[model samples]
Target: MHGRLAKSFKMFVLVALCMSLTLGVLSGLAMAQEKKVIRCFVQAYTPRERMEADRWDPPQYYWKLEQEYEKLHPDIDIQFLKPIVGEYEAWFVTQMTGGTAPEILWRQLGAAKADYVKDWYLDFTPYLEKPNPYVEGNDYWKDIFIPAVSESAVAPDGKTYVLGVDIVGVGIYYNKNMFAEAGVTIPSTWKEFMDIQEKIESAGCTPTSFPLGGAMSNPGSWSVRLLQDMMLDSKMMEIKTGVKGAKGVVKRTREQGGSISWMELVRAIKLGIYSAKDPQWQEQWKLLKEWSRYWQKGFLAAEDTDAYRLYITGKAGMLYDGSWQVKPTEVDSLREFDFGLFNFPKVTEESSPYATGIECPSIGGAGCAAGNFCVPLVVKERGLADETIDWLMFVTAPQNLIPLCNDLGSFAPALKVTEGVDPRLLPFIKQLERGSERIQPDLSILTPQYYQQHYRILQQYIGGRLTMDEATDKLQREMEKGADTLIDQHPEWGLKK
Candidate 1:
């Protein structure tokens, strides 16, 4: 009887042990299932404080999307990693080459698309044709975006690799109180513009804030547009449209249509249709020199943020920045006075190429694809491509996007929002919508070496280190060298005659 009882106890212990092992194995499997993680590398879209606050409350746009996505797929997690603004390009490139790149990446400004699109980014053209599960009905995801937005991201190879979220327009932001106190109106011509600068300066405030300390400085592009607007004429327009010749002589075939192309700019350079030696070109340099005097003291040494701070604090009368400034200047920063926006004034016909006055706001320094994103090829290699693309589509839907646009205040949505935008941004939006006869591409789009040389000489010229003649000569050399390189790189562009 004792032997039988001992055998029964041993059997019971074995059964309990078996049950414990089974439970432990099941728990391990469940935890493994929950550990899925998706990584993203993006630029800072909202203020730092907002991101911190989001940890506790209902999340902001990015955070909200992340949280909702995680909730829907409880087994997966999303991580957004933001690199330092100045180091982002280098960091992204390194990560990509190392095969550790994040699944999603914000496209860097001035990054050569040809350099990475083929190897690093996944072509979304196939996915874009299909319907987005997040959007209503069976509408193609690409169809919802403004046509220009999608068109801007198309590569030379005709594949759409990047997606832009916002449209940015560059302009001047002015302190209304300073203008009123100085008795100056928004100038409509170059002469009046300079005169107002003097008046604002005489009133004991800096006329404007122009930062020249770095390659990414705002003044470099803004001033370039100003020069282009001042110097645009029939001859210039003709060359931009692929017509080439000396001063009064011009030539074009029916094959050379009226539209502007980068090739046209290159051909003009090669043929000397547009030359730094032109009298008008010299006049542009003179205008730049005169304009430099109105910039806040030490502007050449000051950072872009420093210039912005001076403007908002009333120490500067006008701020030359993009529509993106609206949020930071009006919403985030402290300001003692009302502010308004106005375009760079038109140059007189004597200074312009066209008999009709130049457009008030030049449109083309930056455009619809300012905030673009792309999925890295690594995402597909790692088997996360579908998940990553789906999340991007979800975040860009109207319901998700409109709130973020309201928060940003500076950019117009690439997607058409049936819901109204923030009322405060409408004025700036209207300014951007107004057309111009000529819109020059941002000079930064030039080859890096050329853009660097151009801006470096510009900084020297503006800082009194180089004379107008010296600056123009250096610029011409750099422009020719850049054109040569581009022609060699893309012979199909037909930049050469």
Candidate 2:
């Protein structure tokens, strides 16, 4: 009886061991089937503390989208990899070189595309043609973007690589009370604009705030606004459009050439279509110099933040900045005075080469569209391209985008709004609506190095360190040299003779 009882106990122990082993094997299999994590790296423009505080807010679009996306996509985990402030480009380069780049990354504006576009970014052309699953049924994804934005995103190779999210326009933000106090009317012509500046200055206020310091020493949006005005000249337009003999015009070498076509412009420079010696070019410099006199003393040494502060404090009468400034100026700065928006005035026929009937060309300044999010080529190798693109589209859809735009306050959505934008941003939207269809790519787009060189020259001229002749000659030479280098590198551009 004792032997039989012992045998029964052993049998029970063996059964319990078998059950434990089976459970362990099943758990392992479940773990193997867990969701894949998609890594994204983006430039963090907001402070972490601020983002965290607003994380639960409806307008905290980035965080909100992340939570919603993960909930909907149970099989996927999205992670935003934040780089150190001001060191994103460095970190991005390291990641790209080490073959560990995030699945989605921010495309650095003004960076040389040749450095990464072919090797690092996925060609989004195929994806852009398809309908966005996040959009309402039956609409193509590409159709939703504003026409200029859609067209601008396409590369010379006809591939769409970047998807911009917002439209930012540059305009004057003037202190309403200061303008009223000075009795200055909103200017309608270049002369009137300058005259208003003088009037404001005489009223004991700095006429305008201009910044030309920082890493690039960029002369802020005002300078670009001035350039856009100058570019509206009929001769400049003709050169950009490839029209034959509209004053200082030239012929195009290729059927694809237009007045503003990148290659055409490069060819025009190389072929001497128009030089710095041209009367139109000299006039632009003269106008810029004249405008400089009305700026705050030592304005060239001031940074963007300095200039912004001056205007917000009511020390300066007008600030020429991008639409992105609206939120910061009105809400963030908590200014005491009311401000009004105005387009840079029309360059009168007396001051410009264009015909009398031509109105101020709607110049979409530098940040016409917010920077885009691009999928790194490595994401495709890892088989996450579809998922990454889908995620981007989901975030950019109207339902998600509107809240983001409302929160930011400055940028208008790149997607057409069936409903109105944030009321605060309507003024900017109105300006964008009035913009000329003849969009000119930022000078940085063609050659960032040359663009910087031109800015440096402009700073010197503005500070009275260089004569207009010296500045113009140097600009033309630097541009030509940069064009030559680019042509050599991109022979397919058809810019070389």
Q: Give the per-residue lDDT of model 1 (tens digit) for 1-497.
A: 99999999999999999999999999988887666678776464532344552322222467777788888877777887754567666877787789987777777322534554448778888988989887888478888775545545556566666777666666788989999999999987877889999999898888998887866576666676556544655466556655544243222211111134557767777877666666665665667777888998888888878888888888899888877677777654468889988777777755444434645544432223335677878888788888888888887787777676666566667665545777665554455344432333444434778877877887898788988788888888888888888799777885563
lDDT of 1 at 302: 83
Q: List, residue by residue over 1-497, the lDDT tens digit for candidate 2.
A: 89998999899999989999999998876865686778866443221335543322222457777889988988788886655566666877887778798887776322424454446678877887889888887367877766655645556556656666666666788999998999988887887898888898888889999887754533443454345444545566455645556565232211111236566667667767646666655665667777888988888779888988898888898888777787777664447898888877767766656434344444442223444677777888888888888888887788887777777666777767647578766665555444443323345434767767877887788788988788888988887887787788778876654
TM-score of each: 0.84, 0.84
Q: Model 2 — which ten-residue stretch has the worst lDDT?
A: 249-258
Model 2 misplaced stretches (Cα beyond 4 Å):
1-33, 44-47, 51-59, 87-90, 108-117, 217-232, 237-244, 247-259, 350-357, 362-371, 434-442, 492-497
Q: Candidates' lDDT values, in order?
A: 0.68, 0.67
Q: Could you report the Cα RMSD, in angstroms, for every candidate shown?
A: 4.8, 4.9
What value of lDDT does candidate 2 attain over all alpha carbons? 0.67
